[model samples]
Target: MTPLEILSTTATGLGAGLALIIAIGAQNAFVLRQGLRGEHVGLVVLVCMLSDIVLIAAGIFGIGEVVQAVPAVVVVIRLAGAAFLLSYAALATKRAFRPGALNASAQQGSLNRKVVLATVLTLTWLNPHVYLDTVLLLGTLANQHGDLRWWFGAGAAMGSVIWFSALGFGAKLLRPVFAKPGAWRVLDGLIAVVMVVLGVKMALGI
Candidate 1:
């Protein structure tokens, strides 16, 4: 493809991705929490972006097609993802009701690098909706560009970087709210509701 075509395709893909990922969800909430706590926001953003790049690249190379053909894999992922989401939702609901504030410098929870990596993996890879977002939707939209598929993928990847960085930083704005016990309760409740609803949708295959 020509230079102009590549630029156009990438720009289109970026726009599509930004539109798709603006909603409040588990990933967003987690990143925001970390950011507000001033706990490795850059690292969180890096992990989120890198993971997205891998998924988007895989999708561009036909991972989506393979996944579509594997009905059993799809079912397994949906079931597992739903279970996880529901569990998380329950925990969030409990947290919401619990009268306690989140200490930003809480020396209680350990944040080892390996644990952090695991956290990113579970949040990014293990989430079923992420597959549909980066793999299915972005992949199909990117493939529409004929020979400019790479450009589209690049743009989508860039969007992921921009988004996670912005989200992680923006989350700091909520530090005051997150510091309050009631605010945490409310946030947790919202997270619970969203997660449970999404989990139910997945379980029902809707």
Candidate 2:
């Protein structure tokens, strides 16, 4: 492919990946919360971007077909994802209803990096939507570029890196606003709602 063609294919992949991932979801919510708290932001962003890279690559390389061929895998993921989300939703609800204010600094002090990493992994991998978006949709889309498919996949991976970096870093700018307990409550409430909705939808295959 010519230079122009490669650039165009990569750009197309970037746009498609961005379009699929820009939506609201459990992963986004978790990243935002961690960013706000300034707790393991780098690790969270790394895990998220890396996970996307792996999934998108798998899809582009044809593992997407293998995944699609096994409906049982998706079913298993759906059930597990639903269970995890529901459990997270309950925790968020409890936090939202707590009498005390949400203190980011105080909360950060209490957090275990290992726990955060584990949660990040769970949020990234357990969600069925990640496979659907990164592996299946982005993979299939990249393959449409023919020989340029690898470049397309590269672009999609770049897009994921860009987005998660922006979200995790840019969120610090909003730290002032999140300093208040009321703001934390509102944010947690929104997260709880999102988790519950997604969990139920996954459970019902909606």
Candidate 3:
């Protein structure tokens, strides 16, 4: 591809990637919460970014085709993802209703680094939508770029890095607002709702 073509393809991929990722979803909610609480934010961002890169690569390399060929795998993922989302939703709901649960200082060490890592990983990997978006959709789109598919994937990967980094690191700017217990309650309540909706949709295969 020529310089102009390379830039165009990469830009297209970046746009497509951002379109899909910049949304209100379970993964985003978790990342936002961690970012607000200032709990292992860097690790969460890194995991999310790396996970996107790996999935995008898999899709661009024909794993998307394999996934399409085996519907059972997706079904399994859907069910598991729903279960995890619902479980998290329950926890979020509890936090929302429990007074002082969202206290900034109290939440500092409430969850250990290992637990936070596990939660973020589960949120990323177990969510079937991640595969559909990063693997299948992005992969299909990149392949359409022909020999420049890798360039497209690179663009999409860059988008992932930009988004997660901003969300996780930039979240500290909102610390003042989140300082109030009421704000935390509202955020947790919204998170619970998002989780329930997504979990239901996945569970019913909607």
Task: Indicate the residue-level lDDT of 66 in model 3.
Answer: 84
Per-residue lDDT of 28 in model 1: 78
- Top lDDT model: 3
Clashes of each: 0, 0, 0
Comparing candidate 1 with candidate 2, which one achieves the higher lDDT? 2
lDDT of 1 by residue, 50-144 (tens): 88899888888879888788877878888887887798788777766654534323422436667665666666666777777788888888888
Against the true structure, candidate 1 reaches a TM-score of 0.87
Ranking by lDDT: 3, 2, 1
Cα lDDT tens digits for candidate 3, 92-204:
89988887766756655577899989999998898888888789999999999999999999999999999999999999999999887678888888999999999999999
Query: lDDT tens digits, residues 94-203, model 2?
Result: 98887664654444555689988989999889888888778988989999889999999989999999999999998999998887658888998999999999999999
Once fitted onto the true fold, the runs of candidate 1 whose alpha carbons sit more than 4 angstroms away are: 102-116
Which residue pairs show backbone clashes in model 1?
A: none
Give lDDT for model 2: 0.89
Q: How high a TM-score does candidate 2 get? A: 0.96
Indicate whether candidate 2 or candidate 3 has the larger lDDT.
3
Each model's lDDT? 0.77, 0.89, 0.90
